[model samples]
Target chain A: MTTRRSVLMGTALAAVSGLALSAGLAPATAAEKELNIGFVGVTSGPAAAWGTSNVRSMQVRADWLNELGGVKIGDDTYKINIVTFDDQKDPKRAIAGMEKMAQEGIHYVVGPNVDDGAAAVRPVAESKGIIYFPYAFPKELYTKPASNAVLGMIANYQSAPAIYKYLKENKGVKKVAFIAANESDPLSQRDGGVAAAKALGLEVVAQNDTYPNDTRDFTPVLTPIIRLKPDLLVLSGVSPGNAPLLIRAARELGYTGLISTETAHDAAVLKEGAGELADGFISVGGASTPAIRSKTMDEFIARYTKKFGEYNDESNTKVYALDYIIETLKANPKAINDVAEFKKTVDTFGAPNPYVKEGTLKYVGTTSFGQKRQLSVPMVVTQYKDGAFETLFVGEVD
Target chain B: MEQVIANGLYLGAQYALIALGLTLIFALMNVLNFAHGQMYVLGGFVTYTIYGQLGLPFVLALACSALTLAIVGALVEKFLFRPVIKRSAREESTMLLAAAIAFLMDAIILILFGEKQRGVPKIINGVFVSDSLVMPYDRILVGVIAIAMIASFMAYMQYSRTGRAMRALAQDRVAAQLMGVNVDRYSMIGFALGALLAGVVGGLLVTITGVNSGIGGPISIKAFLMVMIGGAGVVGGAIAGGFILGMMESVGLNVLREFGDVTYLVIFVLLMVFLSLRPNGLMGKPWG
Candidate 1:
């Protein structure tokens, strides 16, 4: 009777040890179950295109992932869920979006389209340890505040310098004039323009600031611009409400010079707005020609066109790329979880992607400032001609 | 310096022309035409349809557009304003009704055409260079056209039978009815002529600048202010007031460097001070 009882106890102890080992190995072999993402941006307004496109892109990505059986984690598969709010390009609304997302337990978010919105939401996201991928062009948002939570995708405040260099090297541009609105982005960019002029041995003939945000007429400003007659007119903020007005007035006043504006050669819409006036103008954009070569990009564009009946922009591209990144992370669940792990993983993420183009998509700045995150990402300096944009400069990833 | 003056004058002329129409409607109709700017915008849209879509000559397109809008004005006066006048509705009620209609028109345009500005072809081209002072002849053309239109309009009002009849109607509807003048007919004609002027200004604006969907309300407000500051119910005052406002705007924007903002500020101050000193306006023919 004693021998039979000892044999039964040994069998029970072996069974318990086997179950413990299985549980320990389950995390590595099983799949990730779920992902929650947040989006904050100008979902509406004159620039609603930026925000709406992002939402559509993210939704498409979520659908694609779910169709592929969601992200893989320990033994179970979870679907990606996204929550979005319209910041309307307002800083106050942006902060509210960040807080709401944080409260809802969303650790990942996509955008706050403009600089002001990003700045307002950055601190809140950092304190809450949320990972915010902002798409604004301000430099301070990334480099300052000492937070690992913020990632910027564009060239930041350095686009102006880049543009100036292009002009000097390629176009033999020496004398330049600056015309910008007395607003935050334009004013800051104007400073960069001045710096570029001083650094690159270009003579600054004139620097004029227009009324902050008015479109009644720009003849008051245009007269001085026409009078100075510099070789290049760097229209620092041509996407604003007054851009068309300024351009039209400039043409009317018979001043034909090379105009380099974000609006000058960036989008097809400017071609429609400025008509023949926009022809022969130069501008910088984030996307490179090679980005369109990726099969994934082709698929994305095809899918987006099918779904939304329109092509996407760089902002949409960033959203798609980030969605791709998030899915990648989910595929490797051990890569990031809490703040510290995410910071390290994100830092090592690669450069401005050579394979993404829906519109305005870029990733160089958002990831860490490693060799991979360098600004060597491709950029296009385009000119408007024949009612279309012609590439003047196609930069390569260094 | 010469370029600045020429540019300012050019800009000011366009503003005055737009302002004149608003002032006319207000003085004669005693209702703020909120859609006055929309009428201007509509005028541009019509011209776009004629010149851009239909491929008509620029001048012919502009003329047809103006004429179409004048007819539209007559129809509006007959259906909308005529009823209000016949009912002897409260002044505020009539004004509110006009404002509502303006809102409706703006909404309709926005829904139909989207909020992007349409490029209009430049009407006149050529640079005017004198002593190294260069300015676009297109601007001079706008100013010249504005002056000619105002001069002809003033002359017609002073000499023509229909113009006198309209003036009689404006002076007192009941009194004009007591006279041999057909009050309703004159009112319709007044509204039509007012719309015609606005339509022309709209076309001119598109030629110099460009046309967008959302231009009507602000232009209407500027026109109202001009009439009030120039002198209520005075045709001569409307023209003069427009030029003065234009000059102030031009000087404010170019000379002060804070040109655009300063223009509005100076006008507001001028209006306030003038209102305090002479509420009737600078050249108002005071009845009381």
Candidate 2:
């Protein structure tokens, strides 16, 4: 009887030891699984600002996630790793970067910030069944049917109409003179502006296009436009570097009419470039001033500025993209490994509470794009007034 | 019509100022300094640092920029270009070296000042409005300064001993050396003068437009084109070429709004036609 009892006790002890050993190795294996995301954009060259800001925002988001002990997917916590490539703002380089990313087994890609970069990488992403979030301004990028790409930026059509409407109604602007950089995206924005002006019963007196990248003088372009004497001068789709110079040129040439733009969100840079001339200049889609910002947005701006040394206007959108992905993973952990499941999840995912108040992502299917993959957020019209960006209007585009 | 002409003239003056230094350097060294545009950009930054950031007077800053860049140009010639002058296979290597120097200068400027464009405040504010024409005071100032500098340079080239040596060198290098014109010393002086003009143009441009590191490459291209189109080794030809290009761009942009962005292309085509018709450019001497 004593021998049988001793054998039973030894069997129980061995079973308990095996269970403890398995438990100890479970977390190590889980920790080894990482979710790789790829960032391809212009990290050098003229458009370095866009790429650097995007990367910084993504890094901050990753840091926040890692601090929370990584994102949980299917009871397994996975650290997020961002692999980046600099395309130097060239389309061919962008395509090569995309291919390199695919070879690295990264299925989630963030951006090729400009229109050229986006167009180049779209086919690659679609063919490979990768999830691409592009920060682009063209409708053509999303026109194809049912692709795995989603545009995370406001298209020119949406913002132009709203901006023109505001100017016509509030500022009594009737005749508009339009100037844009001669590029694909800028031309699209110019078309949108023309349409918007026509719809609002406004006359486009002068329409001029300058060199996309190398124009140093706006005087020649503005001289003719100023002669027409329009009520509003629209500098559409110009880069941050050129927009302020355009404004300064106009002001120096004694243009007293209202100046507006679709870009130039960085008020500090604009102010520095244009100085007192930046006063009374209006631009679409920027970070709302501290007075109008929500709690979440304010927190985000503080964190971003602390980390990156400047307040990026697109931080809200970038953070939203990452957060949306995280939330989707939480809903279905298997989606991380399954491309179809991930794509479907993103296509049908509801808007998470965005960082900005009333800044919900609305996926609208348009006749132009024929797809509802374009993410439209609330538009904030900001004016440079008294040495700061003041929120003049906040509403949705009809 | 008045605005177009005024615009053309002022724009021409700027191009002339930018092309002057490049023309001078080519005439003296027979080496196309591809880094000339970077020198222009450096001048602008120096003026901005002195006048904009340091809160010094604008005129003093402009002078300082020109002086500093003259020194820098001399140093570059001595250390960088002087050693390469004697080699038989120097042309390709010198071009590469100029490109490398440009990239290095761009990188240094990028590191020192961030990529954001910074403007120097207008030296004089307000516009002179007329019945049919309006001119900004700062622009008029730029035009006047450009004219004064060009005239001074022309006078110096005609009257001064070093200037006469440079002209003689351009006419016949071997003869000038035989006549006791120290080729090396004159070359350094020529580069310094060219850099001084570039520095002044840069300072003026920062006040007129703005300055960023990226502008170096484009401006360099324009200056190079100006020298080629005007005449390879003639100062007067560079001035004429600058005005012609400037007027063409200004008038072309105003009249051909639809084709405004392609003004550069139009200029290029026109240049091709001109070169085909008169292979020596508008004022260039027939190549040997």
Clashes of each: 19, 0
Q: Please provide, for model 1 over B1-288, each residue's C-alpha lDDT reduced to its tens digit, 9 standing for 90 to 100.
A: 666666656665676677666666665677667777778877877787677657789899889869977987888889998898779757877777778877787767655554455556566657676774666677677789987887787778768998787677667767778988887787788888888888888876676556665566667777787777778677767766777776776666666653323556666988899889988777785121
Off by over 4 Å in 2: A1-35, A43-45, A63-81, A208-212, A299-327, A335-338, A351-354, A357-370, B88-90, B258-262, B285-288
TM-score of chain A of 1: 0.77
lDDT per residue (tens digit) for residues A1-398 in model 1: 56977999988999999999898889954555566788888654345555666677787767776878776654556688788998867899999999999898887788886668887887898888777776655655555344443443434244566667877887788888887766666666676777777788989987754553435667766666676777788777554335556766677567777777643222444554556776776765444234334566566656766766555444323534455456436544554456555555554454334354433222344333332222233356666665555667655332
Q: What is the TM-score of chain A in candidate 2?
A: 0.86
RMSD from true fold, candidate 1: 13.6
Model 1 TM-score (2 dp): 0.73
Reference-based lDDT, residue A151, model 1: 44
